[model samples]
Target: MRWPAKLPAGTLNRSIMSAMDVFPTLAEAAGVEIDSPFELNGRSLWKALRDGKREPRKDWLMFASETPIRGHFNVTAFNDEWKLVQEIDQGLLGADVRTHLFQIEPDPNEHNNVAAAHPDVVEEIGEAIHRWRMLYPVSGTRHELVPPPGWRAPKDWAGYPVAVGDLQDEPAPGMPPPFALPTLDWQHGEAGRLIYDCEPYAFLGGGLCK
Candidate 1:
C-alpha cells in the first residue's frame, strides 16, 4: 500500500480494523462512491491514514469477532483496552460456557484470565457478542465438527461437484433479459448468485438483495 504522494513512509499505526474494512477503505482511497442496499460493517480508514491521525474508527469501542476455529467456534469481543474471549463456543450451550477476559493492551500475550476481576466488562461484551451472533439468519451455517457421512472432498478441480457445465448458462428464472445484463448488474451492484445470494453476510454482516 505504498503511496508516497499521499501517505507518509515507514510509519507505525496501532489502528484496529477488520477484513471487512478492506472494501470501503480501497473504495474511498480510489475515490469511489459506495451505493448499495445495505450498510457496510466497516468504514474507510483512508483519511486517518493519510493525515497520520489516531482517530478511532466507527464503533471502535467494541467489535464482535466470530469464526470457526479448531473444529469449533471462537467468539470474542474487544475494545482498545479490553478483550473478552470465549473459545470453542458454539452458542448452543447456555450457562455452561466459561468466558475469559484480558486487558489486551497490557496483556497482549493473554497470560491472565481477569474474568473474575471484571465481571461487569465480561457481561457487557457477552451481551454484545450474543446480539451480534443472533443477528444471523436462522438457517445460517453451524459449526460442523466434520462433514456428514459419505461426504468426500473433490480429488481435483476436474472432479469438483459444481463444475462449469453443472451451472445454468442462462440467468436465474426471474432475472432480466440478456440485453439488460449491464443494467441488471448496475441495479444489483455487488450482489449476485455468489454464496446462494446472501453475499458475505455470514461473516461481514448485511445480506444482499434489497
Candidate 2:
C-alpha cells in the first residue's frame, strides 16, 4: 500500500520489500538506476527519521545523502509501487549504525510483562516493538532502557531500548555482541536507551564509510 500522504510531520514507518520488487519500481518512476541494491547506514537513516529533514523531488522520488555515511531507502504513494527514497542525515549520536530486520508475532502469554497500562496503550507498544524488530535485527541479547535497579519508562516511548550481552553463534563474522531489548514504560515518561559498553558494529554498504 502507498504511504499516507498526510502522516504526522515526522513519523516513520517500516516496510518489507525485496530487492527485485523495489528496484524496477524505482527505476520506472524516477529514471534512476535501481539496478543494484545499495548499502546504507542504519544510524544515518534513524537520525533522518528522528529529525524532519525531508526534501521533495521530481519523478515522485526523493533522495537524501549524508557525508561519509552513505545510505538510502525508498518511499512511494500509498498505492504506487515502492520508490527509492532517501532521508537527510541529522548527524545524531548513533550515526553510522547498521540494522537487521526480523519478524515479531504477538504473544498473549507475554502480556503481563509489558507496562502498557491501558489495553490500547499495550497494543500500541506491542506494534512499536514489533516494528522496531522488523526494521532492525536484534543482537540476540535483550537490552533494557531502564538502568539496573532504577526501572523507569522513557518519555513517549520515543526510544525503545533493548539489551545486548555477549552471545555466541554470531550472524556475521566479526559481529559485535548482541544486546537485549529495552522495556517500554509509559508511566515514567522515560525514553528508552540502548546500553552498549563496547563500540557499535560497523555497517557495510556502498560508499558507507569511504
Candidate 3:
C-alpha cells in the first residue's frame, strides 16, 4: 500500500525504521521465529513514529497503544508555590493525541463548492467516529478537566473531543475566547479506522497515513 502522505513528521526517519526492525530481531534473539506477519496495534506503531522510534511491521491490528505516557504537557501546576511539590505527580498523557486533527481537510479545489463531495466524506468520517465511540465508551466531557490532586483521568477519557475535532470542525459558542483544536495526524487514524471497518475503497494509504 502507498503510505499515507500526512503521516506524522518522524514516521519515515531512519531511526524509526531501525526500531521497527527490532521486533523481528527480538523474536529471533529469543529463538522464536514468529512466522506470522508481526502483528502490532496501530497505537504502538504510531507512538514509535512520534517518539522517533520504529518497530518491525508485524501483522498489526487496529488498537490503541497501551503506554500511559504518549504525549506532551506543560507544568503549569508548579506556578502555585504550595502546589509545586504536588505537581510532580501530575502530567498530561498522549501528546500524539494533540496532532490527530490536521491530517484531513476538505479538498481545496472543492472549497466553496464541496456540498457534492461533503456527503461521502462526512459519512465516512462519521463511521470512523462511531467505531471510536464503540471502542472507547468512557468520557470526561470537556476541553480540559482537572483531576483530583495526585490523580489523573484515564488517557482515553478526554480523547474523544480531540478525535471529533480532528475529523470535523464544530465550534462551541459563547465559550470565552475562540479556540482551535491543535492540529495533528487526525486523518491517519480516522482513515485507518475506516479501513478497519471494511469501508470499501477507503484510502488508508496516502499522505494521511504515511
Candidate 4:
C-alpha cells in the first residue's frame, strides 16, 4: 500500500466515512454531475486531500455501522469530538438497546459509557439520529430484521443447535443428566415468516433483536 509521492502525508479527518464514498468521489474527480434528485451519502475527500486538512468537510457524519441483517442494528453519529452510539435494536436481555456516548478525543477506544453523565448530549444526538432515520427511512420489514430468540449467529448447516439460557447450568458430560427436556419460548405466529418489530426482547439477558 504505497501512497503516491505526489500526495502529501497527513491525516484527512477524525470523523468516520464509509466505503460508499468512493463512487461519488470518483464521479466528482471525473467531472460527472449527480442527478438533482439523487444524492450521495458521503462527501468527497478530494478537497480535503488537496488541502491536507484534518477536519472533515462536513460538520458531522452519520451512518449505521451494523444492520439487523448482519447481526446487530446500531447507528452512530459523530462530529469532530463526540460520538454517539445508538442501539436501534435490542439484544436477548435488552441490554444492548441503550444510548452510549463517548468523547472521541479522550475515549477513542469507546470503552466508557457516558450516556448517564451527559443526558443532554444523549438527547441531542438521539434527535439527530431520529432525523437521519426519518430522512432515509429504513427499507424492508422490521420483523425480519430482528433476531429470533436465542439466535446468536446465522443459522448454520451443522446440526449444532445453540441454546439461549444459563449455559453454566448445562451439566458436565460425566455428571448425571437432567430429567426434563429444555424448552424455548419462540414467537409462535412468526414460524416461517419474518417478524418486523423494532422492540428488544430481554429474556435472560441475551438475544440481539430489535
All candidates' TM-scores?
Answer: 0.59, 0.16, 0.22, 0.54
Candidate 1 clashes between residue pairs 3 or more apart in a chain or in different chains: none
| TM-score of candidate 1 to 2 decimals | 0.59
**lDDT computed for candidate 1:** 0.60
Tens digits of per-residue lDDT for model 2, 1-210: 233452355464343223334444444434464344765321122222333344222122222223221122221111122221123222335423222121123432223223323445334433444454455433222242213212233333444542334322233332223332111211111222233333433233111111
What's the lDDT for residue 204 in model 1?
Answer: 36
lDDT of 4 at 6: 37
The residue-level lDDT of candidate 3 at 155 comes to 28
Which candidate number would show the highest TM-score if scored against the true structure? 1
Residue 205 in candidate 2 has what lDDT? 17
Task: List candidate 4 segments past 4 Å from native.
Answer: 1-15, 57-59, 65-72, 88-97, 137-210
- In order, candidate lDDTs are 0.60, 0.29, 0.30, 0.57
lDDT of 4 by residue, 97-150 (tens): 578899887998999988999999889888888888787654432434444333
The residue-level lDDT of candidate 4 at 193 comes to 19
Clashes of 4: 9
Which candidate tops lDDT? 1
Off by over 4 Å in 1: 57-72, 88-95, 137-145, 148-210
lDDT of 4: 0.57
Worst 10 residues of 3 by lDDT: 77-86
